[model samples]
Target chain A: MSPILTIIVILVGLYGLATSKNIIKSVFCVTIIESGLILLFLNLGNLEGGSIPILSGLVENIVDPIPQALMITTIVIGSTITALALMLCIKIFHHFGSIEWKEVLGREE
Target chain B: MNDFLAQIPIFLVFIPVVFSIIIYLFKAKWTTYLSFVSQVLLLIAFFAYLSFWRLHPGDHLLVFGGWSERIGISFFHDGLSLTFSFLAIFIFSVILMYLFKFRRKDHKFFFFFLFLEGIFLGMIQTNDLFNMFVFLELTTVLVTVLISYQKSGPSFQAGIYYLLLNTVGALFFLIGIVFLYNVFGTINIRVLQELIGTQGDRTVVKFAYVIMMSGISVKAALFPLFTWLPKAHGVAQSGISALLSGLVVKGALYVLIRMERFLFVEAGFHMNELFFWIGVVTAIVGVTFAISQKDMKQILAYHTVSQVGIMMMGISQIGLTPFYGGVLHIINHALFKSLLFLGAGILIKHYQTKKVYEIKGALKTFPIVAVMLIIAMLSISGAPLFNGFVSKSMIKYAVKGNFIKEALFFLINLGTVTSFIKFSSVLFGPKAILVKEKNPLQIISIIVLGLSCLGIGLFYQVIASSIFGITISTNLWEISHFLDYGLFLVIGFLFYRFVVKKDYLPFQKIRHFKLTFESANYMFVVYLLVVLGVVFL
Candidate 1:
């Protein structure tokens, strides 16, 4: 059920990416896609009533730490790419004085 | 030497990252010298390793962080990786040498330059699926940075579009990786291959295959997903354009090929036929668009799309010779295409214009560069006694006895020849005013590339056998072959004169068609779903 919801979130993100008029919204859409993917990945590693993944002591069960670690890297990459893209978006706005995709394309060189 | 051979894979990646940091920390003046020295060392390492591998002929796997191969990250170096690394390192050195003179005092440029090289090296070396994803993402970011470093109007737009599309595509890749891990409990490619080999087909595996392949197809610039390529390659500086078209885009395709080896066990698969038809369509569409373009850079950019199609067609076939031909074409295309882009860069700078019609008398004004461009153009168009002809004929030989495939190949060649004819017309008119003197470094770099093209054409068999362990029949002197080539040229010339010269209705329609980012994304999603449907249903 939660996995289906994550896919729904991804679908919504894709829709936003396709239809968003504003560039910033599209960047946000990209982040949303990343978030949904990360959620899906984390969901795969989850165990019901699992304890924290640590080396303290042997427990009955624990969440898989691999996906968690991988998600951390994925989150870092997503945030850094988003930040850089938004910086470029600001530069684009300054250059063309518009943030809408259609208007930005319409502006002549 | 044996111990050192084992360590080459690590040094291949490590030297570049270390030197990138070193160059970044030092003064701007030291950046060039440091980069130069590092590239030379990298080149020496690559050649020594390649020569050792040639003698040894075995796979070398380096386990990262001192872990076992079953669970730890591992970098696999084989003939395939070595071939691409050789191409990448050689092109990097040549471009760095050329840019040495034209480089401004920007330390960030050098930093990204070496960093990009390291990422590419690591990408080619790694056998871990998740590690490949990480490298792919890093490359996406670095390329975005390099493309937008100028911060111009078009560059910024191109950069953002590139970021959005690639990020979306890569996220899909991650999704595939997650699915694979969930099903198989491992992310290493070799282990997954062994598991799938024994376990046979499953619903989740096929789903993961289609999703990951769709994502990789975006990077490979396969037919519908190639919208961002032209904007990014055509907008940037020539050096970046050369790198993007020559190496960066091919990196994705390389990963696709690597994955195909492991995931899709041979026979009864749909992707083969799908890739073939896509290649045929991409060839026709790419050239049709190239002919409609008025800008020089845009023409070259579209032509890159077309050549990729040709390479795709070659590799898509089932036979060993065709596969060798395709691999060989990758290297051959890299050489001549980068040479053409760099040469076009020089012309654009000298004329202060990118318009094809405005540029005049390159042959008369810049005779040396003109000759060099002619060599590249000839090689690209597969003219006799050039590098293009050899690999093209190998591909032709590969698809022999299939009249439809042969005819399609001929049509692609004709399109290629006709477009380059239009491109080469700049060589024959009144001289442009106030041409700049040629830079010696640029000249040397181009000359080296040009000579390699000629040398490869002359000694193709030797190079082919040495690199790919296959010997091609170099029967260029046969009268029948000459007649066929002559027919191709005559028809190509006539087609250009009557059809493309007049700019007919269909051609005009192609010119007016533009795929916006929204439609492009939509196309990607549509294709992804379609491929999934085909694979699963």
Candidate 2:
């Protein structure tokens, strides 16, 4: 599909994030959004008949390896972010003894 | 000399990376020694950059891989890049020196700080766009954990928010990079510059500029995208706040500058107007929020928004294209801002309270800290002979090309002065004994920065023209100095009365901060998808 579709995915994901009360659910939505973007990037570099970007000595055309390389970096970075976010989630739960964003966000402080 | 300087610059970037990995095996004491050794080496590298600037003026160096430019990784160091890298490494070295005290019980913070410094240095020096992305991600991962280093509710929530915000911004950045790589066939900055120079302006080029700047503006925390900045900054530890506010946002600004010059040429100049206007709005609204803040660091956090406005305004105004003004202020802000935050860290460590009322009488308790803080206050407020004035005035005159822009920015300056005036009062007026100073290292750092601020103002022209490689005209110096001294006197009085004693709301620790893994995972995927689609389309 078009890039607009991916943007729509982001908007929906954000909508879920703003409205969702569970920290874990919000985190999951963020990852889903990230996955969609990665898929889009992979699609961007796609050739009509291309398989994965691994070494194939065939004469047929292959996808660009740069974006693929970048994707791995992005994925690793994304996972690290996910891990850190979860760690923070655990910390928040420990301090407040609750996962509901509304109850915590309600205070003016 | 030229050959050595150029080769050493590349080695500087690699040495730290190598050392960082090597130290991972036995990090407790080794990391501390490794960071110290690397930081000293980094400082020497900065000095080499200085010599190269003196030796070769207004020239950009592209360190290509042994292969041709397009296919190889290149290190692009320009007048702009060199200046930023120097400032970053200088501050980083100082931070590393102070890390000794912090290393007493924790290797985690120490290791992370060095890695953070190394990543920023690598990001600044690398001309390859893909390499930039790698360093950027490295920075993000390190900083996310830094935000949550202490692991409290507020820290955790802030960490989560920062991750969400930065990830989205980074994805936008990747999208921009993908678009550029598609259109130009190379992501190396020097190569891209040549390509854009040949074609000049096109729909694709303009589209790329907008997309890329959108991503950068997010990281710079400019205007609408700045919502996460204060929360993340306030929630972080004092040192982390300093680094984030003083340097990390600067990474984004540096990239935007490089992109503007290389990709859009003057096509991106229009963003200056937007940047200038939004800067004023951000300054006014941000400081308005600051005046309401009672939480000490949160107030400083909001002040970051205001300071960012001033720095951007320096660059956006006409006849200020070299943007020396913003660069200078960036250095000034990093010095004083970091100093203030570190001092605040000392207080919190002692008193265990961040509230304004609760943090009273710091002057009596920590006399040395009080003195250091006053110096920072003077520097931040653009007082005479301090660094803040030198660059701020350059911006003030630079933005005065028209009546409306002039008026808006003047009001911004007034608001900035007023907000700082308020902070200075709380800093010295409080007589309460909080934390006794345990770390002499932190205080020494504050003093070092304070001196640097004064030195920057005294040698403004030399810094702008000589070290920074900007060709400074006598007229710009004359006008800027006059304005600098003018704003100083007026604002100095404003600080002493009608502003300092005014009561304001302090933002305490955010309560019951929320975290839902499901939502976070979902948001992450969607944003990453946006990056992908942009590349594909």
Candidate 3:
């Protein structure tokens, strides 16, 4: 059920990405999709009644730690990509004087 | 010595990275010299290790922290990975020499460039799926930085488009990994391969394969996803363009080959027929677009797409000969295509124009560049006694009996010949104003590549047998082969004279055709859906 929900969220992001006119919006949409993916991965690693991954007294049904570890790395990587994309966006705006995809990319060299 | 040989993979990946950081921190005047020395030393070490490994013949896997292979991140040194790593280092060294001769003083560019090499080497050698994902993402970032290094508007545009599109594609790959990890509880490819062979839901595996391949198709620039390649490769500096076109895309193809071998083929899935048809379409579409382009780099960029299609065709064949033929073509294409791009770079710089029609009399103004370009052209167009002829004939020999496939091959080759005929016009016209050749380093790099093309063509049998251990049965020197090539040249000349030279309405329309970012994403989605439908239904 959670997987389906996260997938729907991902699709929403995809839809926004396909229709977004502004470059910033596209970047946000990608972030949305990435957030959804992270959620989906975490949910996949969850147990029915899992406790926090920290090993307390009983250690019953500790959620799988690998997905959490992987997602942390993914988050770092994804943020770096987001920062890079936005930086490129700034550069694009500085050069073309508009951040609209049509206005920026459509100009003839 | 044996231990050192085993650790070559680690060194191959980290050496560039370590050098890049040191160069970045130091920012000394001798950074270029230092980088050059490092590359040369790395090449020497690689050759020494290669010889030693060949003599000793032992497993070269490096599991980190002394952990079991299934649990730890690992690097596998096999024939395929080692070959590609060698290519990465070799091409990076050539570009280094080219830059050193050009006297580029930017420490930042060197930093990113060397870092990119490290990431690329890591991508090629990694055996873990998650590890590969990390390397791939890092590569995309590095390539984006390199593409936008010029800081021009078009460069930024191309960089952003490439970054966003490829990130989305990488996300798809990640999702595929999520599904696999969910099912198998492991992300190690070797472990997954074994487990998948024994048991797994067939539908899930099929879906995973489709998703993973869709992501790879973007990287490989197959069919609809190739829109970014020309924009990116066309806008960059010549060395970057050559590296991007020559080796970077091949990394994706290498991954595809690995995935197909370990996962799809291992688990009772055979999509060779599907890939063959896709290859045919990619070839036809790529050629149609290439033939209409007037810009020299754009024309060469589109040909990379078409040649990749041809490579896919050879790889998708069932026979072993065609498979290695495709592999060999990858190396051959790298040689000639880099030579062509580097040559085009020189011409573009000296002639001060990118349009083929506007730039004339290269033969007179720059004799060396012209000669090198001719060799590259011959190699690309499958002229006899050139490298392109050898692999192309191998692919042709595989499809010899089937009339329709044969016709498709013939059509693709004809397209290549015709477009090159159009390209060759720049070599001949009235001699333009004489421009003195200033940089001998540029000449040296291109000459090295050009002679390599010739040498590879001349000694293909020895190289093929020694490197790949595959004996070629196709008689390369057959009279019929030369006759066929001559026939192609003649017909291609006629076609170019009558149709392409005139620049018909259809050609103009094709030249003007452009895909917006939104539409490109839509096409990616449509491509994914289509592949999914084809695979499942």
Candidate 4:
């Protein structure tokens, strides 16, 4: 709900990132932290009881439109980033024949 | 007619994107002739375009879809953006020239490289935050592909890690954007800044600034989130490594600089302090590891981390300070670091060895390559009259008021010099056997770079004056900077020599956290849907 809460989530993400040995898990924790920040941001845009920003005569309380535009672009960007991450995951999995960082790094010939 | 030449800024961004599509469609099957022909033409055209900018003095150029400024999508061209973009184009062209030497098995490499080039070209000019995100994404996707082009396991893993965290970062940037838009009801950056300045006490704007900046900072590869950089840049092919290190990371910094003047002028939020420390930490940590590195590529990778830290140090000066020194360092770093990476590429290719200790006596194998590497090393080490000294001196000058920052900055430069000195010993020693010189393409590319390093040294004042829009009143051959540089170089060498121990500490593994809650794609979708629900309901 608060920006500080968002920062706390980021710290949690960093915690997971630093401690986890499984590559995919670390990535997902980072995702969680990122998502929390995103939620925190959306909450800040709340117009103190503003409704969805639409103009069908069904709602007079419309929120901002720019965030939605940005969100659309962000979503597009996020999907591609996910795809690239998965590709890397597969590469890591295949090459060192293990999913753990220690094993792959240890096996570097 | 002058307008056609003035179209330099736009066409520099345009030609690559248009030709990339053409190459994708028709030149897809035919790689050699078209790739060769197009890159040369691209280089020539790009140079002529930059020269045109030189002629137009202080004329801020803008092109906006043939519409008025507010309604149109604007490309803001100024001294800062133009020079950076020009550096990107120049180095990218060199990559293009050397690209054929490997004759990479996949045309996909060309496809991605060209696309990456196009993204870099467009990103440096756009003034819009939204447009910047789009180009940034383009860079992200293309770079991941390039890094994983070989489908090597280590590289692929590195790519995935990079993507995951960076996606997370970008998402935060987007959320910040949305919040700013929701508050201000506009997406134009200039307008957004003006509104923020007027609002004066919008806690939400400050929140947005912090959130968005952290996201970009992740891309910039600053500390606490820079873990992804060394591995990703390390595993990438030489050309890809060069581009990633030299260009893409700077994209995020560009946004940081643009936003800082207005959005991030807050107290106790000094990126300068954070960045100065980050620069020093990375420089020390990076070189410490560089000394232990057996893999030449990995060593180079660590050096990238060092340079990124230095770049960060330069940019951190933007906080409550009037130092444009950071901008100059960015230019200096881009040129010399790109040269260093390119030099590493030649070493890797020629000797068929990536281990530092294994590739002994490079001077015997390839004299020209050896000479270029030495020049690049000296340039990076802040050796007298080199480009590094000019900016390093400027940063020192800029920090005249901040003693703590100045001391840390000095130490970081010393660290840089120390690492390069270590790098030099391994470079030109002696040849195992005289390795055959490869094709002239990589050689010619290195020659061009070497010439630039030398030219910069010879004309430091001219470059200093040209970029800053101020002529130097002092003598060009002044001994002050050289003396400082020499003192640091000696100090750095002594410090590293005395401090580093020979006991090899085995490489430790970086722990990765699992995502039990949701997948990256799933989280991304949910976030977007929420925004959509909030927007169009």
Q: Choose the strongest candidate by lDDT.
A: 3
**Candidate maximizing TM-score:** 3
The order by descending lDDT is 3, 1, 2, 4
Q: Where does candidate 3 chain A have its weakest 10-residue lDDT segment?
A: A52-61
Task: Provide TM-scores for the models.
Answer: 0.96, 0.86, 0.97, 0.82
TM-score comparison, 3 vs 4, better candidate: 3
Q: Which stretches of candidate 1 lie over 4 Å from their true place?
A: A55-57, B1-4, B51-59, B266-270
Candidate 4, residues B276-383, lDDT tens digits: the string is 665666666665556555566776677667766666666666532224556766766666777778788777777787766667677776778788888878777777
List model 3 lDDT by residue over B85-175, tens digit each: 8888878887776666665678888899899998998999898998898998999999999999988899999999999999988888888
Model 1 Cα lDDT, one tens digit per residue, B250-342: 899788888765555532355766777777888788888998887898899999899888888777777778777877888888989889888
Model 3 misplaced regions, further than 4 Å:
A51-60, B55-58
Residues A14-41 of candidate 1: C-alpha lDDT, one tens digit per residue: 9988888888998999899899999998
Candidates ranked by TM-score, best first?
3, 1, 2, 4
Worst 10 residues of 3 chain B by lDDT: B95-104
Q: What is every candidate's alpha-carbon RMSD to the true fold? A: 1.9, 4.9, 1.7, 6.4
Clash count for each candidate, listed in order shown: 0, 65, 0, 10
Question: Which run of 10 residues does model 2 chain B get worst, by summed lDDT?
Answer: B504-513
- Shares of reference contacts reproduced by the candidates, in order, are 0.60, 0.38, 0.65, 0.51
Listed in order, the DockQ scores are: 0.72, 0.38, 0.77, 0.30
| 2 versus 3: better TM-score goes to | 3
Candidate 3: clashing pairs of residues = none
